[model samples]
Target: MLLVRPPGVYRAQEDTSLLRQVLRRRGRRGLVEGRSVLDIGSGTGALGIEAFRAGAADLTAIDLSRRSVLTSWLNSRLHGIPATVRRGDLFSPVNPHRFDLVLANPPYVPTADRPPSRHRMARCWDAGPDGRVLLDRICAGAPSALDEDGTLLVVQSGIAGEQATLDRCEEAGLVAETVARARIPFGPVLRARVPELRTRGLLGPDQVEEELVVIEARHG
Candidate 1:
């Protein structure tokens, strides 16, 4: 997909690709055909574009970054697909509107003391302390934003507590499980925080890689 990412917008990476792959597979099985789709924390709008290509009847992309909103809008136009791109916190811009599918690749990277910044690039991956800030919020709120029989797919690093996410989803009345996983080398951020993570017991002493897991939750 051709996309224009400004300085502060997140570049499409492994997590993004993982979600897209799942979408493609589900699309082929006709799960996404003509369904209403919502892409939260939309960075470059890649997932929204994929949802569009998957024959989503209605599409919406939301991001906290203004640059991301512009980039997403441009990308949707470039792809000749109709999508509502809005600059706001996750789910805020599209409240009272539920969808058949909700996709999220929220900030799950663990940061020491600082919370994620809404106006900065670090907001793309900085989750507070245990990295549950956005993930937990999404888990708690997603169920309310999904239509009956809707599905929500979220990608997060294992270090951020995969089981915690599942537990949260299940608490929200959804059946959740890890649908896909990929082991990849730690990125610069994680590499820099290895010591802190190790001290916090989130990572093993000799761990050098991180596992990305896609959690799929469905309304029961």
Candidate 2:
């Protein structure tokens, strides 16, 4: 489906495609058929749209940027998909409600610079120091936003500590594990952070590929 991407809205990337494929597999297994799905950080509304095509009954998409909100909303309309797209930071707009599936492709690219970056474009990819800013938040608060049988599918870079995310999810009362993974060449952001990542021991001198993992967490 064609998508509208306004300036500052994140472009769906490889990680996004990976998660969508996983969602399709889950749907084939009947896990997502007729389920309600929430797409946190719903850039371009791509994931939410996929959820509908995958047989989900409803979709609610949230994003922090107004541009992203507009772009995602427009894309949903473009595909004739119905989505309740809202402008708000992670989970805020959906308070007091829960869904069967929560999808997230949050900011996981690490940066030395303090995040929630003032630079408009950087906000889409800049996670605080260790790149756990939004990921950590999602892990901790997902349960509250999920129905009893709900599942959370989140993708993050290995450098951001995949194990850390699993542990956090487990501690939050979720049974979590790495459900999918892929090694991708460094993107422009990672390429620019080579020196900082090396210093932080997240990247080796000769390492050029970053492993991305899709973590699936279910209520324990």
Q: Report lDDT per candidate.
A: 0.91, 0.90
What are the TM-scores, per candidate, against the unseen true structure?
A: 0.97, 0.97
- Give per-residue lDDT, candidate 1, residue 187: 90
lDDT of 1 by residue, 1-220 (tens): 7888888889999999999999999999999999999999888899989988988898999988888889989998898988988988788888989999999999988887576676667888889999999999999999889999899999999999999999999999999999899999999989899898999999999999999999999987
Overall local distance difference test of candidate 2: 0.90
Candidate 1 residue runs with Cα over 4 Å from true position: none
Candidate 2 lDDT for residue 82: 77
